[model samples]
Target: MSARDSATVRIDASDTLRFNALMPGELQERARMRARPDFPWVARQAAITLSEAYRGNLLLTRLLNDRGRVALALLMLDMHFEQPDAPGLTTGRLKAEAVALDICSPGRVGAILAAFRLFGLVAPAPDLDGRRRRLVVTERLLAIHRERWRTILQSLALVLPEEGERGLHHIEDPAFLAAFVHALLEPMRAGWRPAFDVPAIAHFADRDGGMLIAFALFGTGPTGQPLSISQLARSFRISRSHVVGIVQNAAEAGLVRRVDEQGSRGPGVLPQPALTEALEAFVALVLVRQAVAVRRGLAAIGVA
Candidate 1:
């Protein structure tokens, strides 16, 4: 099998151990969902929702803004959900697991955790062992996760109403929340990058506010009309230079193009067709994955 096929298998495998043989069917579902006439709109709205979510929030933008930091944050929550006891959720263990999963460096993970604690997203858990400090997810953090999950489920509802509604119905249930988080984290733990099919997205997916910048610039459609640098920077809580750097990198990769010579002041940054298609595909795949995850979460809690 080709590497793409191999990645497909691994991604599907992460969903459910008993459902291994259903990999082929999952791929079919992904394709069918993508082929839908409304798929592009759904994808765009989802991406916009996710991207806009981080806008105007300084602490959130700093902690969970980029793809890597987002994964790191989710990993912390997933580990807590999977193992809430001592040794299960600690700074050392979280850092180690992050390194093992290639999510980020130990130092970065530690720094983020410090920020999380300072911001009240996480707090020290009571443990008998003094040598290792245990961490616990705060209501603040859980609320953030719930909001993010709700954004995803809302998008899923556009395509798969039944599954999406069911998920939203139990969004606050601890059991369902735990299972849902684990389902989402499993693929990441297994090294599944959402942009696997659209490699060009890595240019935007890696930087802080990169994908969000794309969403802001691209608007709700593929026009990719120009927007002001100051506006983009303020929206994502980044500097003008940062936004310009992301745009320049994307332009070099042919994922986007500048139509004017205005440079950082306010150039006509248009997203190329390739970038639009890639983002659409990535969004569709995310919806599919979340749909399956919702089912898994519902099943885990006997919700049917």
Candidate 2:
């Protein structure tokens, strides 16, 4: 179903209260700073989407690493913007794009390429380029790359119809709005810079690894009250098992502790002070990039 069709229902007061409560103080602060007045709603929706999508990343999270994911994006961009980039992707071209985008270093790019090649995502190009060794693109990633953007666009659409005038015009212009939304979300994701250097357990990664971490560390009520597992699941529409596993995993990793009878409502998940500090550093990195992107976007349209 179209996002418009799916989100046609009005957001109930209870849902509004719950969702707003889910937003961390830090994220709310960033939204206040970066959200365009013309489209103040975009910042909140985008933040929610980023958290949701990053958490919703089931397959891709396990299939690719941080840099490998970038490499895959570079390959698809070749198909997207440049001509003659179809049917195949090359390390040299991927390297240039990666460097231009500041996604990774040349050495890291090489490793990414090698990893993709090792998997079946890429293959040796035809005999024509024997010396240079270009790589052919596989159908394996096409549906994934295309669908992800489609999903993002639909998510934005569900929000664009919201009570915001600034973004309304762009919504009419699909191309413009797509670019605009992309600009808004990219920094949020890239700035997050994925927490794990190594992949989590297959099942955990299959679910929402990033979401788990965020909840494990920052899941709380609007007034900073710790929420019980049932409360967290109810508010987020996440499964109880998922919440349990996430908390258990975080505890295993020493990122948080489950304190029995900790909060007025019920048992609460408390952050390990040392780990919370480290996680905040990651948030700081993303916030800086998001702020810059928001500024550039506003400036582009001659808005303050």
Q: What do the candidate models score in CA lDDT, each in turn? A: 0.76, 0.46
Candidate 2: worst-modelled 10 consecutive residues by lDDT? 196-205
User: Which pairs clash in the backbone of model 1?
Assistant: none
lDDT (10s digit) by residue, model 2, range 146-228: 44444434433443322123343333332433344445445323432233211222113324333443533442312355547
Write down the TM-score for model 2.
0.41
Q: To one decimal, what is the Cα RMSD in angstroms of model 2 from the true structure?
A: 13.7
> Of the candidates shown, which would achieve the greatest lDDT relative to the real structure?
1
Deviation of model 1 at 54, angstroms: 2.1
> For model 2, what is the alpha-carbon lDDT of residue 61?
46
TM-score each candidate. 0.88, 0.41
Q: Give one clash count per candidate, in the order shown.
A: 0, 1
Tell me the lDDT of candidate 1: 0.76
